[model samples]
Target: MPSVEAGTAGPLTALSPIRLEFAQKAFIVSGGRLLLVRKSASDPFHPGRWEVPGGRLEVEDDLDLDDHIRREVWEEVGLKIDPGPPFHLWQWFMPDRADLAGRGQVRVVATARRCRPVTVDATLENQESDDHLDGCAWVPLDEAGTYDLIPSLRPVMRAFLLAAG
Candidate 1:
């Protein structure tokens, strides 16, 4: 569980010497609350679990890391946010029998604040992917643990709450 603090200018040099691929996620916070999404049970990867909004890098569409975060947050939750500097970085490794085994990933976790009033619409629940997201909500930071969040997110959430406080 290697976690990088906010505002890192370069990769996690201390954890690993090997070059690794990168991904990004946003712990979107608003008014002392955090946004979390529920994965569809029909999906394979941690289905029915809670997670922050994010996705793998789209080299073809996203021009850079910040662009990817902006696009993914909107596409996943229909919220406009001003993503702050990355708050944490997780070195991800799937089990040998896992679908994404052998390959590793570095998740650049950033904090963001809502820029506009969230517009509730049908599109928010209707995810475009087959098994990506099913539902989402803004939970109070203190109460976020009641939901079954993704395992890696628990520590990140704790660190974030402490830092924000």
Candidate 2:
């Protein structure tokens, strides 16, 4: 009989798997302005705060990462975007909620892709009534600091501004 070590690759499974949720964000920039969406007041996370347009990946969707981002942008802000390669990456653990039932906080890993509007005159609109977004704006990149943005995204915004300058 062979003894399996707990830390070895042999059949000793004692550790729980770490699950991370994947999400994508678009830094949609047009004419020196960045597109932002305001989360609804009742939103679970970052209520009434502004953030770039994007969302988590859906397992049911057959689209690739770029197309998923495009769909999210369209559904959230009614804009067609040409997504570029990811420019920034960030992750955050979800705050504890009653609904989680002691399952531990969910960790979300997100990528921020630089994107451009497909049309010069494309108008921004919140397409879904039940979507968490309540408002949209094309704020000048230099002036974005004045807005109430999501706290976790402050560093990313700062880096973007610094890089733009």
Candidate 3:
């Protein structure tokens, strides 16, 4: 949530060749299973893949990282989540999406629990225009591992499963 200092005129730009934008992911678990959504085949990146429910953080959101995750989850699946500590952080270049091309997306992934029992809504896809989430499921970690997932998420999912047991 911290911003570049006031006095440093060019430090932000000079520090990195590519601009790093902030994004977040929520690890929502309920009834010993994780909630996963399938991206529509029409998606530009990682189409037809399963992933945790979350999305990019926008400056207009006016939230810290944790709040952003909570908002994104609510917007996506209509579920309220209690966010916990960040479990992982990683950066990647999303060249497939024209708007995101040439920019480094820094994602902070956090674990969270549903505030209450709720149905996963496949109809409420979030702000990312290109990502069409068409299916939803509550699957055990082992079962989830068998499906094709967002490539960067596999390791984190495995680690969460192992720690959970």
Among the numbered candidates, top TM-score falls to 2
Report the error of model 3 at residue 161, Å: 1.3
Alpha carbon lDDT of each predicted model: 0.66, 0.78, 0.66
Candidate 3: tens digits of C-alpha lDDT, residues 1-165: 466776764656644244356666676677777888888888767888998887776778646766787777777777766777765666555443334444544334334332333444434545455457777788886687888988887886777677677
Per-residue error at 95 for model 3, in Å? 1.7
Q: In model 3, what lDDT does residue 92 have? A: 58
Note each model's CA RMSD in angstroms. 9.1, 4.4, 6.4
Pull out the clashing pairs in model 1.
none
Sort by lDDT, top down from the best: 2, 3, 1
Candidate 2 deviant stretches above 4 angstroms:
1-18, 95-100, 120-130
lDDT over C-alpha atoms for residue 117 of model 3: 33
User: Local error of candidate 2 at 10, Å?
Assistant: 15
Q: How many steric overlaps does candidate 1 have?
A: 0
Model 1: CA > 4 A from native? 1-20, 95-126
Instruction: Choose 1 or 3, whichever is better by TM-score.
Output: 3
